[model samples]
Target: MMHGRDDALDALRISDAEAQAVLRELDSVQPALPGGDGRRHRRYAYYVPGGVGLQIQGVSQTYLVRPRNISRGGIAFLHGLYLYKGTPCTLVLKTRGGERLLARGVVQQCRCVRGRIHEVRVRFVEEVDVELFVDTFAQAGDAESGPGYDGGQMLDVLDKLRDAVEDGASLDEVRKSVARLARMVAPRAPAQP
Candidate 1:
């Protein structure tokens, strides 16, 4: 069984170089806001600090996480539970703009900072998800299941499609995505006689 952050990193098979990289990614903790409550002390700058959900392995319930910092590779957040290193978990980050970013990753590092709160680092499994994590744009047409579904999801999907095309997604892949989008927008379209 792993003991501390180092042991956890070892179990994850992360190289010294990778560990160093992750460590450097973390910036110095920030000071508290003036005249604000002392309980709301922020440590680091985060892309989407709070509003992140994490469900432990084999646990049905998901808990909210207070993120510390974010990087292209992974994120370090404050977790209330004792999540061991090398444990598999699902991460859900909701952008300030209200877009959802979901991904699966292993607990690369965990350390007990406070009495019960532990800072946990999770490295994403997919590179594509990492790229999309920072900028999540949902399918506007599929925002809700109903008529007159006017939302930004459609615009987001189009932007993603354009990016995929530029990034060299196969013609077949683009076709499939377009077809899916068409199906999503069908309900909103005027019915033909």
Candidate 2:
């Protein structure tokens, strides 16, 4: 009986190979290192299962599912809904800082598990506001305040850095550009008199 259910799930499953391959490619381009912070964060994220309203392609709809886990790059969710792979959607996340963040993401893969809900993986299409989406919710650190030192500003800097690197800028050039942007955005305090 259980085997039959498993077979049914397999029949409906969407391959995750492509998604994983993309992740690997990104990793090769920029390998993320683990930090020494004592805080324990899950490689996967699971949120309270509920129906979330999503706006996609100028249409609004509700998806019934539970967010399972999230990384800096993407998210995975327990699926019972009928979302298709490559479907573009906007996730409205209510952050701990009492702010609502809108993230544009695309469904990359989906798979069904026997006696368990299906799992859907989504990759963020646009750079997310990390401070609002990750730091606030993950309790990673205190919010920083400086000239142009907001989440949006940081994302812009990251975008510039990525583009520079893709344009064949040397590693030193990339580093210098990032440093200069950081200073411009968040200058240090003036020395005490």
What's the lDDT for candidate 2?
0.50
Put down candidate 1 lDDT per residue, 13-106, tens digits, no spaces.
3334443333344433432111233422112235443236776678656666666555445677766667878999777766555666666788
lDDT (C-alpha, whole model) for all candidates: 0.54, 0.50
Candidate 2: which pairs clash?
A: 45-68, 45-69, 46-68
lDDT of 2 at 19: 31
Over the stretch 61-125, how does candidate 2's per-residue lDDT look in tens digits?
Answer: 34434444465566665544545789887665545465545667898887664334466767888
lDDT of 1 at 29: 41
Off by over 4 Å in 1: 1-44, 47-50, 128-193
- Candidate 2's displacement at residue 161, Å, is 11
Off by over 4 Å in 2: 1-52, 56-60, 134-193
- What TM-score does model 2 achieve against the real structure? 0.43
